[model samples]
Structure formats: structure tokens, C-alpha cells
Target: LGITFDNKLHLSGHINNITYKAFRTLNAIKRKFRHQDNDTFLTLYKAKIRPTLQCASPVWTPHLKNQ
Candidate 1:
């Protein structure tokens, strides 16, 4: 959950957690729409996962190597 440490920015753990959560949400959506086609899942992914992962990007993103 940490984005900065000692003036350094790290994303390994943060991205991992985000991916996990997004996957879980996607799975739930899939279960809810088990009979839906790929298009439906794709749309749901864009609507749900995209926003959750992109939230507060400026705060978590690193602008420089030294961060």
C-alpha cells in the first residue's frame, strides 16, 4: 500500500494488491453474469476494474526514478 519510501517510489506490492482486488471483482461480476458473452465481460471490466485501479493515480504514480 506504500507508494513512497525514503523519497523512493515502489509499485510491486501496490500493483499486486490492486490486481488481486480487480481480479476478485471481475470474478464476482462474471459469476453474476455467467451466461453473458465476452463483450459483456469486457464492458464490465472497463467499467469496474479500470476505475478501481486508476483511482488516485497521481498520488501512487512515480514521476522520477528517485521519486
Candidate 2:
């Protein structure tokens, strides 16, 4: 994450990093199995990617609707 001189918080970089890591994890899973059903992929995504995406949400979650 980036913090500007004006105290502005930029989370896009942090989110992008998380996305990259998650994709790497997913790609590794894909390489592990030659053939998998939709359910298996779904389970893998939920177990691996979802946790990374959903973690520490309260810290960044905006309280105001407009945010």
C-alpha cells in the first residue's frame, strides 16, 4: 500500500499484489491437475484465492456508502 504526503491511502497497489499472488496460487493448482471439474476449481478458488481477497477487509472497508 502507498501513503501519500497528504495522508491519502492508495490501496490499488496492495490489491494488485494480492491478486498476483492469488493468481500464482491458482496457476500452481492448475498445474497440479491435468483435468478437473468445475466444482474442484471452485473449491480451490474458495480455499485459496478467496481467503487472500477477503482477508483484512475491515481495515480497508469504507464505512460510508459513497466511498
Candidate 3:
């Protein structure tokens, strides 16, 4: 697991990490597949970006309203 934790067990770090990774992946896909059709771009997004955002979601899900 690549999840990161602080002294208080807050998930902000983990959330930030995954979002950054997903954004980077999305940018790469956009650059490399700029001319591709929607279906192809969607396929690439599903394969590459979705997982980064959804990884280990259940284990680290926020329980507090402010989290």
C-alpha cells in the first residue's frame, strides 16, 4: 500500500497523492492521444486514470464531515 499517514491518521495526504497521480496520468493521456476518438480516450482513461483515483478507497474513506 502506498497510502501515507500522519500522526493524526488524516487522509488528506493520501487523497492529495492519488489526485496528483491521476492528474498526471490524465495529462499524459491527453498529450499522447490528442487526436484519438472519444471511445479511445475513454478507454485509456478507464484503464489508466480511474484506478489511481479509486485505489484503496474503502480502507481510507473519510468518516468525519470535515475530512
> Ranking by TM-score, best first?
3, 2, 1
Winner of 1 and 2 under TM-score? 2
Candidate 3 stretches greater than 4 Å from native: 62-67
Q: Worst ten-residue run, lDDT, model 3? A: 58-67
Candidate 2 — worst ten consecutive residues by lDDT sum?
Answer: 1-10
By TM-score, the best candidate is 3
For model 3, how does the per-residue alpha-carbon lDDT over 24-57 read when each residue is reduced to its tens digit?
Answer: 9999988988899989988998999998888898
TM-score of candidate 1 against the unseen true structure: 0.62
Q: Say which prediction, candidate 2 or candidate 3, comes out ahead on lDDT.
A: 3
For candidate 1, give the lDDT of residue 62: 47
- Residue-level error in angstroms, candidate 3, position 36: 1.4
Report the C-alpha lDDT of model 2 over 1-67, residue by residue, as the tens digit.
Answer: 3311223665555566666888899889999965999999999889988887777766655455544
Clashes (backbone N, CA, C under 3 Å), per candidate, total 0, 0, 0
What's the ranking of the predictions by lDDT, best on top? 3, 1, 2
Better of 1 and 3 by TM-score: 3
Q: What local distance difference test score does each model get?
A: 0.74, 0.70, 0.87
**Whole-model lDDT, candidate 1?**
0.74
TM-score, per-candidate, Cα-based: 0.62, 0.69, 0.87
